[model samples]
Target: MAEQGAAERGPDGLSRRRLLAASAAGGAVWLLRGTVGPESARAIGTAPVLPGGLVPYQQVYENWAGEIRTSPLWVCAPDSPQQVADLADWAAANGWRLRAQGQRHGWAPFTVAAGTPADTRVLLVDTTRSLTALSLASGFGGAGGRAVRAQTGASLEDLLAFLADQGLGVAACPAPGDLTVGGALAVGGHGTAVPAAGETPRPGQGFGSLSNQVLSLTAVVHDASAGRYVLRTFDRSEADAAAFLVHLGRAFLTEVVLRAAPDTRLRCLSRVDVPATELFAAPGSPAAGGGRTFADFLASTGRVEAIWFAFTDHPWLKTWQPAPDKPLFAHEVSAPYNYPFSDNLPQPVAELAGQLVSGSEQLAPVFGQLQFLITKIGLTGDVTDLLLAPGLLRSLLSGDTLTHLLAGGLRSDLWGASRHLLQYVRPTTLRVTANGYAIHCRRSDVQWVVSRFASSYQQVLATHQARGEYPMNGAAEIRVTGLDDPVACGVPGAQPPLLSALRPHADHPEWDTAVWLDLLTLPGTPGLHAFYREIEQELLGLFDGTRAGLRVEWSKGWAYTTDAAWADPAVLGRTVPATLRAPGAPGWDEAVATLDGYDPARVFGNPFLDALLR
Candidate 1:
């Protein structure tokens, strides 16, 4: 998760705090006792050797959050691309489903549904171990430009480390480094970034989500020319290839050649003093949003996020700007995961969590405040040390310091390569469910979008609070990004991501940006389902899909009805498909048809996919 603000609350930041808290509570506590592995092992007998050889299939397969568990018949760790192809062929032929898993950092069940029967004959293909092949070149296969050829199993952390060595980097990536290239691309994972004011868009480099950077991908799709499933490479320009770029795990990906750029230094700064009403004021409203509004920050830097706690006024606003050189207040760091308090649960939050676990769900409200208090106070201390250690006079940082320091509330400036700055979050971040949405609008309309959302969310939370139900335990995280660019893929006429929240909207030709929103909280809170549904209803009512439209983040939880994720038969069956296949969504239908034709057997289909696609 993007710890700068996503704290399990959304893409990353405090949304991650909810996750880290769940994980920190104790790994064993979350696991379903005497379930998952033993049952499967007893039924399946000894695991069988498959095309790529087997790894004994000893452990119970669990998602990163420990939410989903399964006992697979085999854990195939293929050593080469051919082995992966062979396994796919075998799975298709034997009527067995193949679920690919990398870091399993996401909550979505793209690989396998959580409650799939233990007795079912499913094979778990662990790509992170053996399929990690990477290579860098000045000019690569698809675009004849700078690129890196990496196996799907290669983690984003490793990919960036390799790029760092080669003096290259991408526009943006998910906050956590533990994600595999395959998993991140499958759902079109992204970071919050866009072109700054007066800046021209760059060729072969997109300030959009990570999926836009894919020049070409090699996957195990059924080739009509061949009698069985085989390794096939599709250039970004091909209409059918659009589906693979962000197919939500409907297809199996092996490797990709991603566009790259010469690395640049960045300055990441944080501030937590802006009042919510002023920062997210509605259009034409006299809310007197203090200093620079959220839009103003984006106009200058084009990369920023605000983490507004559920019940707190001050948001932990963070802005990352391009800095060619280190500044006096900037801390020089080479690696990521710099926030130790966030990485590990602090004592107070831990104790409160312990209490919450022991039938004190009323403490949920206190939990939210503690999250804000700890982050506010802890981050302030860190920034104070950064400001003080350099002998910068404390009195110089007086009233309205955020105004004079930097337009974005400069608490502390972290100077490092963009990759390092982007990934300071650990994998243990969020194990709880988080709901997310992306609103498509122009950069100028960002505040209107944010304000509308904030006002509505406040009302819903207030309603729940009146009923003594604190469903939201974290921040309603906000982030921004541009629509995915077709040119960056090096496809002569590539299309944008079909399901990307930032996909260019036909009705809003002037709207080139997307506003990401998320509210994070601990799992198992009473009335969480009903609470989430109300928020969903409120967001849908406000955005309304005309000049402003709505879409769900692929990786996080969504389609809430009764605290259950991907529930709501209407949403699962109708809304998602209709939205993704909205008017002007280039090649969306062709992409689906191509995938369907390739996997006529529907081997990748899960209950979620079948329902949505039906």
Candidate 2:
């Protein structure tokens, strides 16, 4: 099942029920029931019966977002496809709106209505518990390829672990471990690397956003003429395939079949306190390795990643090496997942000496505590300590928060304060900064292979130019896999490939590479959007000018403007479909049309999508 979002805490730290009650207190009476049609019943194989009468808001309050802690509603956790169909029928019959909730991980308020719908007037189908089946199937789509079918509720981390256990892995995956497969894919979550050759690139390629890497999907939708039905599609036809691959903005996905890769182990090395400007410089510079260009170093290396702490000169750099085929001792040495940063020394004086260097590491304890608090509130396991800490720092230093300063001139954001202090002590902190995560891997048949190689190389060059500084203090990671789904988003053709092709040979060795990047934004600042836009534009210009095969991950943000580039205008044409687009549906061209006139007051609409449509 998917994890729930963090809600406001009560006196005891648990979410307060009073808040939920308050959110659902005012709503009109609504009765919704489904009388299944013969065809629908046959397809669903028996309609699951639900309890009669209005479900109370208090019953469903636990599923609301933090912003709507006061919402009250009863959630019907459907157990099967049949149950979903029945609920759809009920909602249609009673004129009650139905909103699907998978893991309830989204930070937005779209999942629940503010007033009327929350008070038992609207119905919520909690799919997390309902769709718990995850399995692997072979020969389902030609021989030699494997398919991983996950019910809507599966978590990305769980799915990865499961795939790894089976000697299989996904082509690409998003960063957050707790995000639900359904939720992630719905909003177009993505993974690292660019799309491969012959692949249609999505908006953002580097982050490997959700819209890429979709093989086939099944969804239950309500239609005015046909009632409710299941829709399915595959990546056979170009337009239809691309449309289904991203879903544009259509039906809720109930199940997803992803192409899986063979399993392989990786060895990682990480270094903290690198310079930002030197990290992004071109290869062959003195500050760089001086042997091969920085890009060449990354290409020869298996994988490379960096994360920068805003307002600080030190960055973290991580590189990965494929594990040898021969066996190695399991106890070579490693840090506990709960304390990824425990053993790391303070940012090196060499990296920060001239730059801003803080006077003390006194905030380490509070930082650790805040990390614990964030995990507890988010319901993520303690295992996330390593992965989430950097993100917290990025968010805190990016000036996204309101608290600008603390008592006695301390920066409100701990990471930012540390960065400021570090710079105050070191003059080099004034240099431009670039920080984020990157991963390297052996390449394969996937289309993104070349672009992945190129981006990694480029990042290395950038690091060198900035003077040996990059971020990503954490260990580098590697995983192996055989090619599976060609239609998946991050693969070469789904959208724009993040990485570009290099070379004389189109087909190379069995090994490939995957790189990840995380750009740091200063907290309490407003330049993030501009920074991202500028960098993205520069990258696109370089790639396009050179005819490099690189593509960026669309989920982060993009420079693509054509409606057909990433969006399926058909499915997004209307608020709700006039005809239900079945699972695997390449929805209509109109689906995205209404986005041009989106209303924030309307549920399921956001500024980003609105901007995309415009």
Candidate 3:
């Protein structure tokens, strides 16, 4: 990776992108620009005055899992939308390419990639600083929720916290709060929500990925009339707006209006007694399991997630239900990241991961079982609050709270606001490489999807274990979501997000639900890539390319090879495009063409994106 000072000019030796990565120190002020620390190898050329101060590129960029690394020419942090427009225009006028970097939490190369030098004239836009704006609409009369406007750089945690203060909440959100709005939407990040048992979706929003809530977005695009890159707002009503809605990072969004609802109280329960064989049984297997099956939970609550520890019989099942008020036996919480055992990486687990990554590949199973035991203890230990330390709990309450603990009449249910409970895992917690896929199928077929996939997953793992190739480190996650409704955009004639994993199946309208499946393992673990490839093959094999199919969870790892992620040429060049171009699915070629029209010079693209869009 190349390192250099900020460019005072464009690629033609002028100030195009005053790119500067945001510093963790002294956030909002952003007065002291990032100077070239010891890592930067080159100095940026001479430049004119830019909005953000020019300094050497000193930031060392690493993805969340520390799997990918790259040094960009400059980390440009624009203070305003106008500044962004100017920088983009100048970059195009020259020959430099720009890639936006949010929290640097994602595995994909959408922003910047390893082995790419900074001197290649590429700029990484750090939006976390000045771009943190969150505003709510006022003076509107409607049955729907309020429309909130947020900048692309706002972290989900900050955005969620602000919304909590405003008495508003979102439909669904990923677990980590450190995820940036731009990065999340660029990759269609989602959480579990499927209309929660007859609850109607708001007029201006739907129960899908974070992207479906978008009403209008502003981005820097080439304007022939203006003869330069300028800030342009696209409403859902426009045809081309569909392209920007989910352009796979091919286009950039500065700010967007997201529809939000009044905050609601939620109850979350953790169940760890269900066996994998019964919980994930075939769609119509049998009713003899005695206990409720995964399908039963989905039908009853509509919000369920199954996290099965590899090689373990009882997978942890989490079910969330709408509780208008505190239940008789509910525990109360006011903040997030409540799961201490998960939010902060455990020392033993970290050691296991270190060993697994260091070449003790056979220890994968042992590490996974240990993790499962810790989770069980985390949920049911003497202090059920998993997070509350013994000393702190005793200090908070000396008598009644302590006596109740002794009596064993402690609470059984967790009661908290949606925002607080929905966001429990903090960033840098349990950093590991993972593969994710969302399978769209009929709600009735969810059991089949889960059962079949689980069966195939276990079979593959066992076959590999026989060959001494321990590829799994324990748990797999399963979640569900409703298809994105077109009307959610609030545009008179808008369509659903073109590339969202929850996008509907055109032919079989009954296929409106999606089952999200994910496989997790320690990064750099031997045989992980090949192991994930086998799982990917199993998932794709079960879909059959008809009424049911699979879409990659873009923000996460995918396109697996024997040794690395995003390295499968066939999956990139053919599988993804062909799947998107299926009979019922919308036009892939058309979306690519529309995006190309938006930025003729490919200003916001990279080699990986070019392959997918091409």
Candidate 4:
């Protein structure tokens, strides 16, 4: 590989370009921000003086994938919850909207829309700065079970670690640890898990999203008598609190008290030998060969994830089983991000990824194979040539490359506290653009759902491949979890998250599980949006209301057209609300009306949210 000379090289032998490519594929925070110098970064424009002596700064706003960027945006970090309420009142008075920002790790234009004008009357309230106070709720054992009160800006890593220290933890959480508690709850983020065989869920242990664990939340809402936005606390049982549980950026939550259970050790095992065909096989089809299908694992442990690399025969399967004590053969880990190879890219993988992203669209298959090989070698420490053809192996890997990648310990089987295994993906994993959805179906139809979707995905890829169009060079990730059952929160009369993707369909009471599917790809791949649109349409049509329903994962990409995401009017106007709840029905209508009632001025909305959430 040619480089720009040693001047652009890092301390390692790899060039900066190779390092960047590797980072883009794995560990870097994919972003492009404004280049304004610090001297003027804090320069206030025509904004009125903020309350609490807060000085707003001119900053660039960009989402995780750099797909949404706005420059010269005014942002501020408040010191207290009262300051946020004051800021909201100021925004309403000054004809400006306020959007709460935390880590900015989401895909959808929930925070700020693409092509937002530099002079847009939107003020971004950054919560990660100083409003991250956390503490245990008083009288933790009353009726709500064990609980912790954390400010919205507190990171999941910190909150989970705090619970772990006290011998308490939530049953499930998102893989990334950097996500804000506020952001995760607001979007209904979830992890892969459900009840295994005859297992019982302990009190406060919910199989649904983080929002389902909320005991109470404090938010800045309108106070009719006060005639301004004021901090208000809402218990889980309140009708309005149901709307606030997963507001989708339509409201600002300053703090929340969440239910937690006693922490249990977990044993996570990884394997790369499961052929996708057999693993995703139909429920009772002989092609399954009575093999270890996705449903088989789901029934056994209830905690499983399948990562199938594009154009690959085998998918990486990880199953986490509850282990009260560490298994004798399991490697004990103390912290999260046990998969080092995934967090950091190897040289060969980085080089090929650079070429692929640089316009060698034909290299997509090769890149996919390389990624699978890396996982196989990293997980099981298998360096045998049998994994790849001799010619391709000789071309892509050498003794030097193997040595560089094998420096880390094998993570095939790991046993540790729940936090260590539950949060494995670090901020550095491949930052690809993803289109996400949740297919609701009976728990018995897990394999059926997986098989149908996988089959459609393969046909779509084959069609694109026949035309030499490789819009996806990444993988398809699938996981299964239970729906948001409010009983798990232990709050009597508590309503489910109205906007959560895992919210059980009111009409289909038997559909208990949610199959989460996300298709990942490099951000700028040609024909990507069209490819995604085809998949989205196929999914919506396939799942209709017959036996399953499809709901858009609010945090990721969706409503795709030929060129952009969140742009399909038909989807936003008709399909989405209809899927969640019948149009003009209670679930959709109630949430919208409540949110509108709280912020009648729409001071908490952006253009995109106003359109989709209307």
Number of the top lDDT candidate: 4
What candidate 2 gets wrong by more than 4 Å, as runs, is: 1-74, 92-97, 104-123, 141-143, 193-212, 222-225, 231-241, 283-285, 289-294, 324-339, 342-614
- Point out where model 1 deviates above 4 Å: 1-22, 25-46, 71-73, 138-145, 201-203, 382-411, 583-587
lDDT accuracy of residue 189 in candidate 3: 82
Superior candidate under TM-score, 1 versus 3? 1
Which 10 successive residues of model 4 have the least lDDT summed?
29-38
Provide the overall lDDT of each model, using Cα atoms, as 2-decimal numbers: 0.71, 0.37, 0.72, 0.85
Best by TM-score: 4
Q: What is candidate 3's lDDT per residue for 1-614, written digit by digit as tens?
A: 12223432212221111111111111121122235632435445432233345332545466775566554346667788787777777678787777787887788888777657656667677789889899886533242678788999999998888888988887678988888998898888889977666766544446788888877789889898878888899876677777777777898889988878777888888877678888998755674255477888887887889998887777888888778798877788788776665554443455455556555678777666666655665665443432443453234333543343334322225888988778876653676678988898888788888888988988998898898888788579999987777766555677777777777667667788889998887665677888888888778889965758898988777898888888899998888776666584556777898888879999989888887789
Q: In model 3, where do residues sit more than 4 Å from their true spots?
A: 1-56, 138-143, 201-205, 287-291, 382-412, 582-586
Cα lDDT tens digits, model 1, 513-585, are: 8899987766655577788888887887778776587888888877888758888887776666666664644
**lDDT of residue 149 for candidate 2:** 79
Cα lDDT over the full model 3? 0.72
Q: Using Cα atoms with residue i matched to residue i, what is each candidate's TM-score against the true structure?
A: 0.87, 0.51, 0.87, 0.94
Clashes of each: 23, 141, 16, 5
Cα deviation at 566, candidate 2, in Å, is 18
Give the Cα-based TM-score of candidate 1 against the true structure.
0.87
